[model samples]
Target: MTVNDKLQADWEPKSDAVQRDQRAAYDEMRERCPVAYSDFLEWSVFRHEDIVRVLMDPDTFSNAASRHLSVPDGMDPPEHTEYRRMIVQYFQPERVDAFEPQCREIAAKRLQSLLGRDELEFIGDFAHWFAVRIQSASLGWPLEMCEPLRLWTQKNHQATFAQDRPAMAEIAKEFEGYVHELLQIRRAAGAQASDDITGSLLRQYVQGRPLRDEEIVSIVRNWTVGEVGTISAALGILVHYLAQHPDLQQQLRTQPSLLPAAIDEILRIYGPLVSNRRITTRPVEIGGRKIAAGERISLIWISANRDGRVFEDPEAYRLDRDPTANLLYGAGIHVCPGAPLARMEMRVAMEEILGHTTRIDPIPERPPTGAVYPGSGFATLPLRVR
Candidate 1:
């Protein structure tokens, strides 16, 4: 069927029901209608098999769903290939290794601030701050930019959830302004520019030419948004999950070596990222649903990761599951380039958190508040730590 013919809504993405508990809602959608249609998301592919198919076939399921330029994330091959080459170098093993100390220091310091409190809101007191500080430190941004970046991330999430195109554009422009000023300072410094990620971006070349200022801004914006939002959510999810499962928490705390695999398993059970967008380049059929060319598609990462078809007893945490099958960082050519950095950051954060505290318990009187659409994990996670 063509786009015009399939006009009925299969789900309400913004309804309180779905927003209140997205994981459960998505799981329902995956089983009932794997390739479902909605006005807000256009077409949401909710199953692992279908999402994997789209990820593998980028030519047919193009990532150029956004009207705005999104550096490598919103670009398809040839263009995506070239820019990805330049981008990947920033997150190389050596670069990530060098940043490990700084990442841990930030995490340690943030955890110290929350230690005295008997009950704390983990998201505000620690998770968001760690995300902002580490991202700034990683990119050589001024510490003063932390608050603005945090507020900007919040506003960006609100704008995205509302699907406010104008607001999103204005927010993007605001981010561009911040990046442009940073670039200008570096340019003025000439040879004295700080030898950091942002400064080095000024020297990067793409297709035999230096990257444009706007392109640099786009790349930085993408990284900042990705790093801040997802890391914060992941931390909250990891902590909240551990608080509920004290046995698992104690096990991980006792054997810190199990954290890498444990963290991945927990996040797979509860995804940090909600979804990613794609556009159909040609007529395609997924899960017996027909979709036409030029239609927008949402690859529901949260749902795909929890699909029982691929993950047996999908909600149960299992460390032995095939790591490659877990779509935590995604798969195929456009998989997250910063996965290594993100993993390192999370592991360090957890290590410091678990090591510093003897126990982490959820405040039963003040239950955690789940973040709404476009955002995942707990928005207000109250935990008692000691």
Candidate 2:
């Protein structure tokens, strides 16, 4: 397909689609524009191998300043390494284990509340709400703060797709102001930091000194804002898929032991976090295309995860698929720090949903994922439950 054809398809979802099926269009782009460049959006890398190479070789395709629109995860190593190390423990296995009961409780409570509703917007009601609350509580933030933070995060995300820098800047300022207040309160109260992730960060002494207020702000921004939306979006897509394939849902429900595997399969099939941007620090050739220094390259994770080069049946969802090779959480040094936690939340959420309900079906009339990145899903997913 032509570039305009691809752009048209990609941009189409912003208006017409559910935000979950952008993969077909992106897969087409990977074949057509493996190293495609846009004067407006820099380079776009679509091939699975090429994306892997970039993700693995952070020194060349540096993430130092390419994560999101800011400089936290965008900063490259060894600084990024330090920051990652300092907070990495927060999402470690044991830490995630500690939050399990809370995750299940939140999911169970939400499911209970929705018990008899004929229809519900799963994204707004359960997926987004539960993930936001779980993440907030995990970080020691008051559950009451979830709505405000959710609003700010949505505004910040919407601003990214905005064409004006001034508008994005204004949103950034607002986000910073709110985070700043939270940081101050947490510090002044000299509150005994709870044994959770946020508390761990607060008590952490990076480089042998207490983390600075600005540093704390950066960590929380990266944690809270960067996290919730993707998980919610992914959960919405997973739920929709499970609803459509009742047999698969049955398989999962019958063998709850299969959930972890099933979650990985679902993620591989419909990874919520779509693309990550990387800048070329040096000229390089990838997938037979020359990429010059300073150009932006989007590591199309959603496309890569679905590439036939890696997955045997790239488009099919198989619960039996081994997840070690999947790029859903990405690969290499800059891989997502919160992946373990996300997985934990998803497993618990799905378990609760499956345990409480027998079957789920997509409404007959629904939108498709056309061109948006990370595929927004389910404006509303109404399911019939027991």
lDDT for each of the candidates?
0.93, 0.73
Can you write out model 2's per-residue Cα lDDT over 27-141, one digit (the tens) per residue?
Answer: 7777766666554455677777888778888888887544344324777777777778877777889989988998898889889999788766677788778868987888777
Question: How accurate locally is residue 19 in candidate 2, as Cα lDDT from 0 to 100?
Answer: 43
Per-residue C-alpha lDDT of model 1 across residues 1-386, encoded as one tens digit per residue: 56756488999999999999999999999989898888888899999999999999999999999888889899999999999999999889999999999899888887787799898899999999999999999999999999999999999999999999999999999999999999999999999999988999999999999999989998999999899999999999999999999999999988999999999999999999999999999998989988899999999999999988889999898987999999989899999999999999999999999999999999988999999988999899999999
Model 2 CA deviation exceeding 4 Å by range: 1-21, 66-72, 191-196, 319-322, 366-371
Q: Which pairs of residues clash in candidate 2, taking residues 3 or more apart in a chain or in different chains?
A: 10-371, 19-375, 19-376, 64-74, 64-75, 64-76, 65-74
Determine the C-alpha RMSD for candidate 2 after optimal superposition of all C-alphas: 4.0
The worst-scoring run of ten residues by lDDT in candidate 2 lies at 4-13
- Clash totals in order: 0, 7
- Clashes counted in candidate 1 amount to 0
